[model samples]
Target: MQNFESLNLFAPLEKALRELNYQTPTPIQAKAIPPAIEGMDILGCASTGTGKTAAFAIPILDFLGNEKPRTRAYHPTVLILAPTRELVIQIADSFGDYGKHMKFRQTLVYGGIRQDSQVKSLKHGTDVLIATPGRLMDLMEQGKVKFDDIQIFVLDEADRMLDMGFLPALRKIVAKLPEDRQSMFFSATLSPTIRELAATFLFNPISVTVPSKALTADGVKQSVRYVQRDEKVNALHSYLSSDKVDRTIVFTRTKHGANNLVKKLERQGIVALAIHGNKSQGARQRALDAFRDNKIKTLVATDVAARGIDIEGVTHVVNFDMPVEPESYVHRVGRTGRAGAKGIAISYCTSAETKELKAIEKLIGFDLRVENPKFKFGESAPAAKGGKSASGKSQGSRRKNKSYKPHWQMKGRNKRRSKTASA
Candidate 1:
């Protein structure tokens, strides 16, 4: 119930919040801003659209505004690291929005384009530098950026960072930071691994956990449709063709799958864009911008590409392929139903993916409502008639198919090979 004014933030920050029409503080913001402004380290567990960005950004801006720290060339006072370029860009944008009234210079450092501009920005001096690990490491090696003067450090989407195998780079970067700096670690889930990771960066940090409802797939109308593997594209196309879908993001398991799905949708007269790791930074940003502006209503992306992206008014999130990890299911479904808005998450599940679906169900602590949609573009009936069971065998097959593996696991094994293919 606390408001931004009650947090007693700097006058400039309070003015900016009011101009942005931000009145009451979210749970994470309410709990994190007070101590964060007091120069306390924070360990926060919150998901996208929970006002997590403001939780850290507000405090950092307030501190910078009040102290009026000297901006050093190649040495930013505040460092914020995210897992992907999209996330890094979004974080920088959040800082821009929240720090509008403050007198501070901020720059972004990420890969996929060129370092000349980023290098120039660094040389010009910056107060807040937001970057991704890979490009930041490259810059660090070339002595383009330094962390010697860092006053505040934030690692947003800590879980995603670890998932993308950025631990070594994170360790190297953390080693360069000043021990006297205020560290804030934010993650979607504070698993044992995350807790262990936070222990290394944070010093006597105050832990803030958002209510469980915000972390889970709450406020979303979730449903599962049983369909054969071949029917997935048509089923998805049918859904997209409907008038109800507005600003939908389709999740595919692989980069190739995302591309293929986009092609299929385009052939079906649907204008959709695909984004994955293989896409360049510019391409990803263009697609994200198009989606945000409603220039494109449908966007197909892999889990890795879509993580930590906060786009409002997403009406639907279609799971063209179920995520291999149960935790990813929560992240995928969370794309919609954000900021107290009602959303629909439709997951298409084949018999081979039943195990994955069950894992997701177990993680979410409830069953997804089964939906049986009548076929329109297709030539036949629902998947239930003459369909394989969870065992991935025909109805007449009595013998156990011991060689069966979940679709997601099968995809996992070929990930190394798939890496070489374009998204």
Candidate 2:
């Protein structure tokens, strides 16, 4: 409970943890690892940056490393199913790092690339297999993969799998696995839908929830700017130019929005790359590698593409477009302020998005600070007559007759007005 050493992990695993500089167990790890080591099915509710991967990965490695090797041809001892290709790769890397001193063979398979390499790896035997649901199903249908030898089955990001319409595939995959095996379900948020799905797979699972005071990471400082719809790009440019923003991830609502934002940033002499579902796996990986290696300062992405991205030294997260789902905001800002490092989350909100912002605030149970000086608290347009601010307080009470004059709008107002009139 106090440290990883106290968990009685195998010597090799302990050594690997020390090599990875994992001195203390995170809250989720501290609670979930013990039960997981006991061979009990685990239901964990933890977000991306909370070290949940290690909570599950360490116990599995410790158990498999000590167990006798099964004489199986195409079957793996452990199977981890994730939603995104990025997550599948990330989880595979964690297993490799944790099992370095052991003789655990692991292979990861996902879509968006040739399967010849993955098939060749599967032709040999492996102790661990990590894969995305779609490719896993494809390989299974071809009889190239087997779960007969599986001792443990892990469903990582269960909610994401459902969100991406993998529920049917997941059910089909789970039906093939031996019901006698231990199951582990880990996700950021466990809704009723996820719970029902878990019930079908896990047996008397030990539930663990690492509660946060706020949905966002503790190290992230959150703020918002009241900018007009058209002026968001300028505001983002201004913020990124600051010295405080070393490396940042800018979240947009749509894939096109992400690409367009990158273009706009490039025109202004700011270098950035965009990642979305449409990008090939190689392209997405290249952009992520550039950002991680510090070759690029900013990476533009949509909510779906940004999932499972774990990079260090990310100083800021810019929400170019507020997400309709409040839970997504938590995941967006979570890209930064990771691994106990301090980071900042800034949201650009326009008048049209006030309702979405309010919904996010209500979900998070706090008011985001309005940090833009040009827009006074009561100076902006009246919030829809009966609407409320993100704080759940009445908007009419905060409305004022005074008009706001943004600095950017003042300079080109007449020229823009003339151009519009001429058109």
Each prediction's TM-score against the native? Answer: 0.87, 0.86
The C-alpha lDDT values of all candidates are 0.86, 0.85
lDDT of 2 by residue, 1-423 (tens): 888888777889889898888878888998999989999999999878788999899989998877756736679889999888898889988888987888778889999999988988887888888999899999999999988988999999888888789999999999999978989999888889989988999999999997644347668899999876656787788899988679999999999999989998998889999999899999999999999999999999998888888888989999999897888898888888876789999999865677778988997888998897578433444356768643345655544525645445555674465345333
Look at candidate 1 and give me any clashing residue pairs.
none
Give one digit per residue, the lDDT tens place, for model 1 in 34-102: 999889999999877788998999989888888989987898999999889988878888888888877
Off by over 4 Å in 1: 215-218, 373-423
Q: TM-score of the candidate numbered 2?
A: 0.86
* Candidate 2, pairs of clashing residues: none
> Could you tell me the lDDT of residue 311 within candidate 1?
90
Q: How does candidate 1 score on lDDT? A: 0.86
**What local lDDT score does residue 300 receive in model 2, on the 0 to 100 scale?**
97
Worst 10 residues of 1 by lDDT: 375-384
